[model samples]
Target: MDYNLMREFADSWGLVAMALFFVGAIAFALRPGSRKMADEAAQIPLEDGRS
Candidate 1:
């Protein structure tokens, strides 16, 4: 619970955890067949109140 212990953990395992999360997110964003969903998501703001 001390500052040094927390800082050491953050400097080591925290960096690894963040790096893994970043790579996973990049992989998800670039996966196959995601373009259609991404395009649809991109248009959500332009759509009016109509369905």
Candidate 2:
């Protein structure tokens, strides 16, 4: 295996990949379905009378 090639590739593309992943995560988190799911999860205990 070539360590130099691996390091260069990682340095070049790793940041882009990480940035894209972060943006995607943020977008998904702000989506309506995500909020709805969160709201439903918050109501579970209330519905079950466990609160």
Candidate 3:
């Protein structure tokens, strides 16, 4: 419950955790064969009830 301890964690581990998440997200988005899935998702709203 100490403020200093929490701040130190946020300044260190929290920063590194967020950076890794950012890198993973960027890599996933840029990977091969993603465009096809993205295009399908984009058309979801326009599709009829028939599957």
Candidate 4:
């Protein structure tokens, strides 16, 4: 494949693919029952040796 063809495909479809992935990631993060897990992760640094 030539550079022009590859560049064009990346310029168009690559942008679309990246945008869709971004939206899907945002949706996953905002879904129900995720807040508790996020909060627990946030406290890891402050927690002691206790597991």
Q: Show where candidate 1 strays beyond 4 Å.
A: none
Residue 1 CA error for candidate 4 (Å)? 1.5
Q: All models: lDDT?
A: 0.97, 0.88, 0.96, 0.97
- The residue-by-residue lDDT of candidate 2 on 1-51, one tens digit each, is 599989988898988899999999999889877888989898987785654
- Model 1, position 1: C-alpha lDDT score: 100
* Ranking according to TM-score, highest score first: 1, 4, 3, 2
* Cα TM-score of candidate 3: 0.87
Q: What is the lDDT of residue 43 in candidate 4?
A: 98
Best by TM-score: 1
Across 1-51, the per-residue lDDT of candidate 4 in tens digits comes to 999999999999999999999999999999999999999999988889875
lDDT of 3 by residue, 1-51 (tens): 799999999999999999999999999988999999999999999999795
Q: State the local distance difference test value for candidate 2.
A: 0.88
Q: Under the 3 Å rule for N, CA and C atoms, how many clashes does model 3 have?
A: 0
Q: After TM-score superposition, what is the CA distance of residue 3 in candidate 1 from its true location, in Å? A: 0.4
Tens digits of lDDT, candidate 1, 1-51: 999999999999999999999999999999998999999999989989775
